[model samples]
Structure formats: C-alpha cells, structure tokens
Target: MTTTINANSHKSLIRNKVWSRLRAVALPDSRFHHDYSSFIADFEGSSAATDLLQSLPAYQNAHLIFIAPDNCLQELRYRSLTDGKKVIVTTYGIRRGFWILDPEQIHESQWQMASVLDGMENIGRHMTLADISELPTDIALMVTGTGAINLKGLRFGKGHGYFDLEWAMLYSIGKANQRTQTIAVVHECQVLDEELRGEVWDTGCDFVVTNDKVINVKDASKPSCGILWDKLEDGMLEDIEPLKELEAIKKRSRAG
Candidate 1:
C-alpha cells in the first residue's frame, strides 16, 4: 500500500510514530534493559565500539565529527589524539539547535563529562558549529540512526530532528561523500526491515554500527542526490525555510 504525506507533516508524523514505538521498546523496564551505565559497559566491555571504529575507512583521516548524547546515556567520549590531530564533534544546545564544540575549549567544564564505555579515552571529541559553512569539507562526521527517521527501519533515534537537518545540509552542499562517512551507532534491537518514508530534505547514512555489526547503506543507483529535485513539491520548499534560501531552488522557480 502506497502512503502519501505532505513534507512539513512528514517530520511531525514520522517523529511521533517512531518515538511511540521506540519509547515502548527502549524506556525504563523495557526488554532491552534501559540502564545507561550497563549499556555503555556492555558496548565497551565487548569489542563493539572499538571494532566498529577500526573497520571504518574514514577513521584513518585526522579530523572527525561525533554527536553528543542527549540523556547522558550511550555516548562516546574522545580524548586528544597523540599526533595533535584536530577533531570536530557536533553537539546540540537547548531547543534542538546545533553547535560545534571547539577541541581547545573542551576543558571549560561547561559541557558535562561523557561516560566512556572503553577506548574513548584514546579518541578526541570537538563540538561542531551551528553554521555548516564553517566546517572543513575534507573531514568526516558521524551521525546516529542512519540520519533519517524510519518507522520500522534500522536504528531509529529518540525523535529529535536535529540529525536529519544536519545531514541534509551536508548533502545539499555536496559535502557528504566517501571522504565523509556519516555513521550511526545503535543497538541491534533498533534495527528494522521496514521501508522508511523520506521527503526531499531527508538524508540517509553511509553506514550503521551496532553492538555486533556494521552495515553500509549506500546505493550507487541513487547517486549523491538521492531524491530527485523535480519530485519536490512547491509547498515543500516553502515549509523548510532553509531549502527556500538555496540558490538552486530560487533559480528553478524563477525559470518555471
């Protein structure tokens, strides 16, 4: 059965639907066990995060981007690299706005110390800036949950739309590619086979990492521009102010 939805409505609908299912499965006393410390220990106790880190091609590159945890649970803590390498970590401020943390200023103590499972001490974490234009095009940034909302698809987030907007910005500028592999770290339980509905602005990830595995989701046929621009409706662009600001869209509408 085919389902149709407006672009603006997509975010709220998908978020509500996905979070409803996730809260049922991931909340306190759930089957998966919602203990943050235990979950971190489990991932660190085993070869999960370390193994996943080692397997990525972008890891060899110096600069990297990581996300901050929302609930003080299941977060990666990074230490300075011995080679004096720089890293960029994307963290969110209150109200779901994006901000970049400077590596040099990480010691200010304003940011809470993230609990480490293991091996996180060896890595470094720098907060990312709100402006995507400030980011280096060459660095690789990792995101959670395939960077998109999925009703039953693998690794859904807790329903905040920040990750999707960040990824969509990168894709819009043609900056997310092999050099920049967007990765998602999730539990095996969050992974699902259900096909997710995506609008033009939604972005997908390059790889997904779980406690036991890493799966690549790149589709060669889909190309870097996954969704066809022509398929986007006029009202959809108006709904997302950022899209309306893009030169391509402005030029297209003028030509039409």
Candidate 2:
C-alpha cells in the first residue's frame, strides 16, 4: 500500500511547527509586553502598523474598514479611528457580534481607548449581523491576523476559526466581493518559506505586511460568496450565537 500526504495532514504539520516556534518566542515577558496575551508573540505589531500605513495608501483613502480586535492590531485600529474612518470591530468570540464604530459616535477623547476590547464596548456601537445585513455600508479594507502565513497568501488563525467565519458571514450578506481587499500583519518570522496547500473553504489574503517588507500576493483566491454550510461540522453553529442568528436571517431571506 502506498501512503499519501493529504492537504489536511500537511497543514497540520505546518501549524504545529509554527505554533511551537511562536510559543518559544512570543510568550508574555519583559521583552514582549507586561500585559501580553497568548495570541501575541514576538511580532512587533506597532512597527508593522507603521509600515502598513506608510506603504499602502489604502489606509488613508479608506472610508470604512474592518479590523480585528487583537493586541497586535490595537494600534492599527486606533490609527484608523483617529483618521476618522468608519471602523467595524468584532466582539470577542462573537459573544455579542459586530460593532460599527464611527469616530463621531464616540467622544473625540475616547477614540484611542475604543481601539481595545474593553473600551470598544462603551465607545462603539454594537450591532448584530442581522442589523448590519440591513445597512448600506461598504468596507474598503479588511485587516486580519495569522499565526503563520506564506508568500502564496495562505494563513491560519490561532486554531480557532473566527476570522474565516467572519469573512464567510460578510460574504454571505453581499458585503464582501471581488474588490474586497484583505491584508494580514505578521512578523517576518511568521512568513513561511514555501506555499501552503489551502482548502476550498480557506480564504487567502491579498497582501501581507511584515516589519521588514510589504508583500503583494499574486493570484490570491478568496471566498466570493457567503458561508460554506456544507463545510461546517455538526453543532458548529450551536456553539456560535452570531452564526445561528445569521443562519436564521439567511433562511428567512431565502424563504421570501
């Protein structure tokens, strides 16, 4: 019998190696940060944000942006709000779902504070996927995270599938399209040397910015439509309230 190395097995090996390396370097300590979370490693998130802002004019031009709420991305979120861009932030683990933040909604003094998880609750306008589905806002840019990524634009989150699910939800509601630009910020060490075998349901980023360089991914393929219900396992939606609500909304729309 011949043994075959499938995509899943290959991805698992890569993920394990990356996570191991990240753990060794990124664990919270004096060098990283006093308040570092597990998700944050040795990545210089603030430096990378400065590089992204300088290299890409999109940050300056974007009227609306969707950025993840992670320790590394806090500065980027702050800059986005400070620039007066309408920002969309996800509630941690989607417990309560998305927040649409306009700088004008919060007092000018609180914009910087609202960039983090705790402050966002008070300063941002929290909304459900159902509420956003009814709105007419367009996201010009999306900033995402990765435990590890490759030059081919393949990326995996910290085991949990929040970013992918968020993308699927937005795509399903006619929010994300071909023109939607996704960017990932990571440390130079997080960029892999080879291409990754990606699954159909796995989305790709259009650009990856590291502290050292800005990579423009060519031929990156992202999901053009909504959730891949068939790809989801049983009880997946049961664990996620936002997903359940979005599914219900999708079903009602289909029925009508």
Instruction: Judge candidate 2 at residue 84 and give its lDDT.
Output: 84
TM-score of each: 0.53, 0.86
Candidate 2 lDDT over 104-219, as tens digits, reads 77877888788877889888887777676776766778887677888888886665566778788877776766787888887766789766666666778888887777889998
Per-residue error (Å), model 1, residue 32: 17
lDDT of 1 by residue, 125-236 (tens): 3222325555665446554532222322233343334455545545555555545556655555445565555544444566666667777675411125533446554554
Candidate lDDT values, in order:
0.43, 0.73
Reference-based lDDT, residue 73, model 2: 75
Q: How accurate is candidate 2 locally (lDDT)?
A: 0.73
In terms of TM-score, how similar is model 2 to the real structure? 0.86
